[model samples]
Target: MWTTGAEQVEQAVAECVELLGAVTGRDWEGVRAGRLEWSCRRTAVHIAEDLIAYAGQLAGREQESYAPFELVLEEGAGNADALRVIGTTGALLAAAVRTTPREVRAFHPYPFRSANREGFAAMGVAEVLLHTHDVAEGLGLAYEPAPGLCDFVLTRIFPHVRPGESPWRTLLWATGRGELPGRPPVAGWRWSNNLVLGTERLTLQGVTPAAAADLAAVGDGGFAWIEGGPVEGTRVGAGLVHQQYEDGVHLPEWGMYVLVRREDGRAIGAMGFHGVPDAQGRVEVGYDLVEGARGRGHATEALVALSRWALDRPQVRTVVANVERGNTPSQNVLARAGFARVAEDPGHLAYELREPGEG
Candidate 1:
C-alpha cells in the first residue's frame, strides 16, 4: 500500500498553496466557491482551520471531544495571508502525524468517533483537495490534483466507493460534488475512517481496502507482524475483502480486522466476518494466528470479543464459525470462545454463538 502520512499531507498542502497563490489578488470575497455557499476566501480559510484542528487533536491527545480551541485570523487578513496560514497549519498537522505513535488515536466525529494519525492526515488531504476544487471552479479556473493524491484519499477513507475511470471523478462523485457515468448521483455522503475495537489485550483494527489489497499481495498490510504472520489464511481472507470491495458490496464494519497486541503493538493474527448477516441474522466469522503466536489464548480472546460485538448488533442473532474436523485446536478455540457445535459435515464442524438469553 502507498502509505499515507505526514508526507501526503505536506504534498496536498503544497499543491493547494501553489494553485491558490496565483489568484491571491482576485476578489475572492465577492465570488462563491463552486457549488458551496462560502466564498473562495472562506473556503481557503476552512482548509487552514481543518489542518490546525487535526493537529490539535493529535498533539493534545484530546479524547471525547475536539480540543477547546479554534483558529482565528487577525481582522483584515487577505487571501495571501490565508494561503500562508494554510501552509503553516498544514506543516503543523504533518508534524503531528510524524510524531504520533502508530497506536495513538484521538477524537473525530464521523461515521466513527475516533481516528488515528493516518486518518487525520487523509482527512486533511481530502479537505485541501475538495475545497480547492470548489474554489477553483468558482474562480473559473481548471484544477485537477495528482491522481495518487486522489487515490490516497479514496483507498484510505472512501473504501466503500467503487473505483471509477478516474480516481478524481470517483472521489468527487462519492462526496456528492460531481456526476459519474452509469451511477446515481450521490445524494449525501460521509467518508469513513476504518473502525478499531478494543479488547483486554488486543485492538482489532478494521482493515481498509488499501490494506486488504496489500495484504492479498503479500505485503504487511501496513502492520508490524510477528514472524510467520499474515499467514496464508490471512492473505486469503484479505483477497476476499478486496473482491467484495471491487464488487461494491463491502460494508466496512463487517469486514476483516487485524488483531494487534495492545501491550507491544505487534500484529499476531486476523479475525472477521465472511460478510454481513444473512436473513436469519447469522454472520459467519473466521480467524488465524501466526505460528509463533498461537496457543497463547490470543485467538480465543479475539473470537470472544468479536463474537460479542457481532451478537450485540440488532441485526445479528448468531455468530457462526466452521472448523475442519481434523483441526481440533481450532475447534477448541471456538469452544472456549462460547460457540456451540450446531452442525457437522464430512469435512467440517459448524458452531454458533447466539445473543445472550436466546434459546
Candidate 2:
C-alpha cells in the first residue's frame, strides 16, 4: 500500500506554489476564492496557517485543545512573500510528520478528536490542494493536483465518501466545491479522521481504507506489530473492510480496529463490527490476536471495551459474536467480556451482549 508522509506534504505544497506563482501579478485581494467568502490572498494564508498549526499539534503533543497560537504574516506582505511563507510552513509540517512516531496522535477536532501522523499529513495535503484550487478558480488559472495525492487524502481522511469517476472530482464534490452526476450537491461537509477508543490497557485504533488495503495485501497497515501478528484472520477482516469501502457502504466507526497495547504501542490483534446495526439494533463482531500475544487477556480487555462502546450507542441494543463450537478459548474471551451464549448451530455457538435491561 502507498503511504502518505512528509514527501506528499512537500509535493502538495510544491504544486500549490507552482500553480499560484504564475498569477502573482493578478489582483488576489480583490478576487474571492471559488465559492468561498475569503479572497484568494486570504485563502493562501489559510493554507499556510493550517500547515503550521497541524505541525504544532504533533510536535507539541497538545491534547484536549488547539495550541494557543496563530500564523501572522508581516504587514505589506506581497503574494511572493505569502508563497515563501507557505513554502516554509509546508516544510515545517513535512518535517513534523517525518519525525513523529506512527503511534503518536494529537488533537484535531473533526468527527474524531485526534489524528495520527498519517492523518495530519493527509490533512496538510488536503488544505494545500483544495485552497490552491480555490485560488486557481479565482485567478482563472487551471489547477489539479496529482491523482495519487488526491487518493492519499481520500483513502486516509475521506473514507466514508464513495470514490467517484475521478478522485479529484469526487474530492471536490465531497468538500462541496463541485457536483457529481449521481450524488446530490453537498451543502455541508467535514472530513473525518478515524475513531480511536481507549481501554485500560489497549487503544482500539480504527483502520482506514488505505491501511486496510495494505493489511489485506499482507502488509503491516502502518502499524508496528508484535511478533507473529496480525495473523490470517486479521488479514481476512481487512480484506472485508477494503471491499466495503470499494462498494461505498463502509462507515468508519463500524469498521475494523487494531488493538494496540497502550504500554508498548504494538498492535496485537484486530476487532470490530461486521457491519452497522440491523433493524433490531443488533451488530455482529469478530476478533483475533496474534499468536505471540494471545492468552494474556488482551482480547478480553479489548472486547469488553469495544462491546461497551457499541452498547452505549443508542442505535445498538445488542452486540453479537459467533465462535466455532470447538474453540473454547475464543468462547471464553466472549464470556469474560460479558457475552451470553444466545443460540447454537451445528458448527457454531452464538453469543450476545445486550444493552442493560434489554430482553
Candidate 3:
C-alpha cells in the first residue's frame, strides 16, 4: 500500500493533522517555523497547497506544465480552518493517487520533467513529514512520523542518501533539516524520478531497486515477459543492479531497464549501463534478449534507444560495449545500432559510440 501511493499519503496526512490540530488555539502566526522564515500558519497552508497541486497534476493528466491554478485561503481563516483544508486537499491527493495508473506520468520539473504516481506520492509524503516537523518544533508539540514512511520516501526518491543509524534522522539530515555524525552539511538536494523513453515497439522501462531485487531472484521484476523470458544474463544484470541499490549508489537512470513490447506488454529484453558515467564520461552498456525473442531486431532497437539516451546526457561522452570474440550476432546488433568496433583483444571485442562532437 505504501509503495502504491494513496495509503501512504493518507497515512502521512492523518499524522500531520492529528499532530497540528491538537495545538490549533496556539499562536501559529507569531511563531516562526523551525529553520524556516515562514510562520507555522503559513507552513500548514503550504502543505494543503502542495497536496492539491499534485492532485491536479495527476487528475488532469497535466503535461508540459503545472495545472494553472493556486490554492487561496479566504481572509480571516484561522488555524482550524487551515487544518481542515489540509484534510480536504489530502483526500483529493489520495484519490488522485488511487486513480492514477502506474504507467501514467505527469509534469514535474526536478531532475526530470515528469513523474509517475509513485513519485508524486513520495514527494507529497516528504512535504507533509518534513514541514510538519518544522511546525511541530515551533509550537513545542512533539512529533515523529512513522519511520516506515520516511524509509519509503528515501528509497523511492532519495536513492542517493545512504541509510544511517536512524531512518527518520537520516531523512532529516538528507533534506538539510538535521545533522549527521560525519557527512558534510547538505547544502542542496533534489529528488529524482525514474526516466522512461519510448521506441517504435518498445518502452525502455527504467528499473527501480525494488524491481531489481525481484528480477535478481529470477522474478519478472513486475514486468510481463515473453515465453522463455529473462535468461541468466538478465538475472545477473539485475543482481548487479540490486547490489548497487543495497550499497545506496544506484542512480535509477544509470541502472538497468526492461524492454517491454508496447503492443502486447510483453517484455522482450533488458539493456542498460554497467554503471554511471566514468570520470571521463565513458559509460559501459550491456543488453540481452530472451531466446524466443532474439534475432527480431529488438536488441538493436533497445541498444539504439539506450545509447541515444546516454549520449544525450551532457556528462556522457561515449558508450562502451564489450562482446565475447566469438559472438558474431551480438557484434552485428551493435553494428546495426551504430556502435563501431573501437578495440579488440584475443578473447573479447570492444565497441564505443561517441557523441558527435567528441574528439
Instruction: Compare the candidates by lDDT and give the number of the best one.
Output: 2
lDDT of each: 0.93, 0.93, 0.88
Put down candidate 3 lDDT per residue, 1-359, tens digits, no spaces: 12566888999999999989888989999999998999999999999999999999999999999999999999999999999999999999999989887667899998678888878988899999999999998998888999888977876777667778788998999888889998888978887777788899988988776577778887887677899888888899999987887787888899888998888878888999989999999999999999998888999998999999999999999999999999999999999999899889899999999999776
Candidates ranked, most accurate by lDDT first:
2, 1, 3
**Candidate 1 pairs with clashing backbones:** none
Please, what are the lDDT tens digits per residue for candidate 1 over residues 69-149? 889989999999999999999999999999998889999998789998889999999999999999999999889999988
Which regions in candidate 3 have their CA more than 4 angstroms from the true location? 217-232, 264-266, 325-328, 343-347, 357-359
Per-model clash counts, in order, read 0, 0, 0
Candidate 1's error at 218, in angstroms? 1.3
TM-score of each: 0.98, 0.98, 0.90
Error of 2 at 324 (Å): 0.5
Can you write out model 2's per-residue Cα lDDT over 30-80, one digit (the tens) per residue? 999998899999999999999999999999998999999999999999998
Worst 10 residues of 2 by lDDT: 1-10
